[model samples]
Target: MISAKRIRIEKNQEVSANYVKKKMDFINYLDNDSLAQIFMLLPISERITMKEVCSKWQEACQLAWHDIKKYKCTNTIVRNHKKCILTQRYVEKVLFNCGIYLKELILSLICDSSIMPIIAEHCKNLKTLEFALVEFGNKNTYRFVEAFTQLEQLKVVKIHISGYNFQFRMLNSLPKDINEIHLFFKPNGSPEISFDSGIIKSTLFTTMLFNSDPVAPSFFSLKKFTNLRSLTIHRCIITDIIQEISRKTTLVYLDLEKCKTKKEIFTFNQLLNLEHLNIKDVSFMDIPNLLSGIFNACKNLKHLDAPDFHVDLAEIKMENWVNWRNLVHLNIRWQASDAIIENIIKHCNNLEFINIDELNSESTIELTKLENLNHLDFEVTNIDNEVMVAIINNCKKLKHLVLPEYNMVKASIFYDLSKLQYIESLNLAFSFKLGDSAIIAIAKNCKLLKCLNIKNCNITSSGYIALTGLKNLEELNIEMSVNVEDNFVVKLRGIKSLYCSGCHELTDTGIIQFIKNNPDLEFLNISFNTNVTMDTIIAAEEAVKNRTNDTFLAIKSVDSDIEKACHEASKNRTNDTFLSIKTNDPDLEKACSESQWLIDC
Candidate 1:
């Protein structure tokens, strides 16, 4: 009784349905290992639903997460459309599946009350825990300890208290047998809870401020704990503690911050085994004497963070020069004369890491002399071309280097880094004169680079294209790069994070090419581009959706979606501009900005 046209349309519909069924059923052919790998990459939202699709997939999801040893629940979302790990549903899923196998747990929560109870009931094998939580006085402190008391294997706990007023009562209820504890809080009220200062555990604690008093003798004690190897105390009286620990030869690491002493001077000679001493923001009246004592005594000091070293040439006693040979890390945060710096370099010849942020004179420290340097940080510093050339030529063994924020070096001098074959991370974010040749040289020689940050250097598409050869690069920051365009992006591959904000030459089709080409791309910032438009956002979202949809054709579907995006763009994109229709659409602008916030925030 049906017409001939209706019969033809029905036949075509039947064939189309059969094709879709075949495509949907393709997942059943994948082996367990392959399915598990696919499940591992699926975002939290779809992965949960995908597991319920079939019994085989359920097993694959289980296998995918069974080996996880660390569980992190945070508000940081690294990818678009994926819910943050702090979401209760996601946290519950992780805890329910792999909580028993977890050895470490990290929680960065907004409100303290919501998830603490849920987390405490799981992760029995957790050996360490770190969290940031709000304070609620005594009742919350009791709840906090009760929640964690079940973790029998937990040995280390680091806590960051968040609240407007913290009485620091949480310390009393913390696990007593915990061998190592580090607590960070802004002490707001009176100091109430106390610890067994005599023979207590090794602890790194920031204590309550004692009403502007320079010393708080009765607040805390450090009479014993001979087994303690590391100690960090902040804003408390440290004179007596030092007197007590001076004889504790087992102590090797000490960090004192803003701690004052009732006495005018002290000595560290007794702590001969000290290897790492970090003193910051403390009274400097006795630091010179303390440092001189330390230099004279501690023969194995590998790490020293003392900015209070305002010592001059005369105080640079050659008798202590032998101790400098063992120094591996030196951070000059404040004053240092050219002669003192030269002596530091001359004596600490085996130094592996040096950060001098306060350098003013280009002649202060000769870069060429530091042949053994592995990491150099000159951030916020000023240096001339001669120093730049010396670094390029001499410090070739550097694994990490941060050039001055701004430099006047010529492109020719910047382009000849053929000797730095071992460089791993380089930040040329504001070196304005650097151009394509420099990037080409870096790509040719620095093949081991993993992080390259060139936020606003004078780089063009050719320079960016040269970067495509850096297969090991994981993060690239090209914010405000004016010359970047689609030809460079479409050819690039395998980067996790890319910041290309203010790149005006990129368009929707080019960005679509990038999104579909790079499967591992987690973050992309094409904000403020002059040519990108609404199609780019829709394409990015579509590509990500295809990836998380649990279909075998997800990647193949991306290309088809891009074709659709082109068609859609031609039909609707009349007002967008620069990485946008034209940068005038309010809705498109909001979308571009929000895309950047997932990672930047």
Candidate 2:
């Protein structure tokens, strides 16, 4: 019933709507600033594309460029690429935009003369600073010396001064509140450099001697460090530092590595609060003076790690047996003298964990019979079957036991281990004498066992069947076991971490089946299993990547097949899901070494 005029008006309204939409699209395309702002909200990888939008957009980003620079929420920042002069400028630009307030800073490069000064002025609030590869001449070294005086809150500083006859005015310019300091100087001859310890609380001297000097006060002239708590001297033969530490009562942790002393016979009696002491590579085996200091003064000693100990009772007086109630972790490595073991047995009643890499029968006497022992490692060269039985019977509370290499007996060796019901982590690897019977006995007992390493052991497929009952098991290392087949992995559904590495008989089908079944598994090492193909690895990696946050799902598979899968997964890792792949490659190891927190076991 409508007229011709009304129909015409409706058609015109529809055309006008289409024209307005086209005009709005054109406006959006022209506004580069607005586009850049929108791009800023996207992820880092996506934002890289914004640079190509237009020159105007790139200029707009300059103002808010701090948002574009990378941020490391973790402890370390590892960049793969190398830096040059131009790259340094770019780095500076990014850092400037990111703001100068930093918790830690490591500048390792061949920077310009003025770079240090700029950093000192800008990074006033820096807590830890490590200058690694920078080189400076004698005159340029003093340029940034006074600049650090403003950094009043600095705690730890490690700087490598590389130059001959370098004027290190920083000694005088250093602030007094610093708790830790590590200096590396490369100077010609005996270019004297001294530090004012008025502000230092806990200091470490890591000096590489360029030349020798007789009159120098050595590395440990503590006339100023009255508040020092811990000290570590490395590579320098300045034994005078030890004498200085003898007077220090506040010292708790003392590490002296490769520091030679002229006087072999030295006694210490001063340090009362010293708990952890490590004196290594001094070459003096029969050090009675050092022993006197340790036995008498360090009453609060908790953790002791001395690798070279002579267990000779003839050398140590029998009447000097002092009780160390506070001793907890005792590690006596490579005891050349078996008599020292008796000395340890007499004292160290409160010892909980004892790691003896080399212990003879003479040393294993009354100490192994301790009821308080929870963790014990022995590399006994001269151990009888009776001595082993005594160790197992007496130390019923033992949770971790690692026998010496080439020291495995028959299956009857584990007959006494049933008494140690609390044993959790057992490493009978390289013990070829322990057959399936031993493993079966272990499964029958030691229900708390979590980590069982039978690598290079004589374990057949039947041995793995016994492990099916170990529901609490987490890690199992059965590397190089020829008898372990595909069905053996089926028994490991509860296990979170598994190492079937070098199982040449294992194929892709077995691995696929295990992955499909064990959804709780987080770490699986199929390295050296050549039968596992790339297709199967890819499928497993994809399945793991789709899992939830609490599910770790790590594949520690090496070789070309696994590496290819990992590379593909890494390229697609976008969401909160993290994929960690461990390989024999150096690059992979380096990556793993960096992310220490991600390691489960």
Candidate number with greatest TM-score? 1
Among all candidates shown, the one with the greatest lDDT: 1
lDDT of 2 by residue, 46-126 (tens): 344455566766665554333432232221112222111223554454345442556566665434556566666766666
- Model 2 residue 292 CA deviation (Å) reads 4.4
Clashes of each: 16, 3
lDDT of 1 at 269: 80
lDDT of 1 at 204: 38
TM-score, model 1 to reference: 0.66
Point out the worst 10-residue segment of candidate 1 by lDDT. 550-559
Candidate 1: residue 119 lDDT (0-100) = 61
My TM-score estimates for the predictions, one after another, are: 0.66, 0.58
lDDT of 1: 0.64
| Runs with alpha carbons beyond 4 Å of true place in candidate 2 | 1-225, 231-247, 256-268, 280-289, 311-320, 333-346, 353-359, 362-365, 380-382, 406-408, 468-472, 490-497, 512-525, 536-601
Writing each residue's lDDT as its tens digit, candidate 1 over 378-426 gives: 6767777777677777787888977777777677877875468998998
What stretches of model 1 exceed 4 Å from their correct place? 1-69, 74-102, 110-125, 147-153, 172-179, 184-227, 231-251, 254-273, 279-290, 307-317, 333-347, 357-367, 430-432, 512-527, 533-601
In order, the Cα lDDT scores of the candidates are 0.64, 0.60
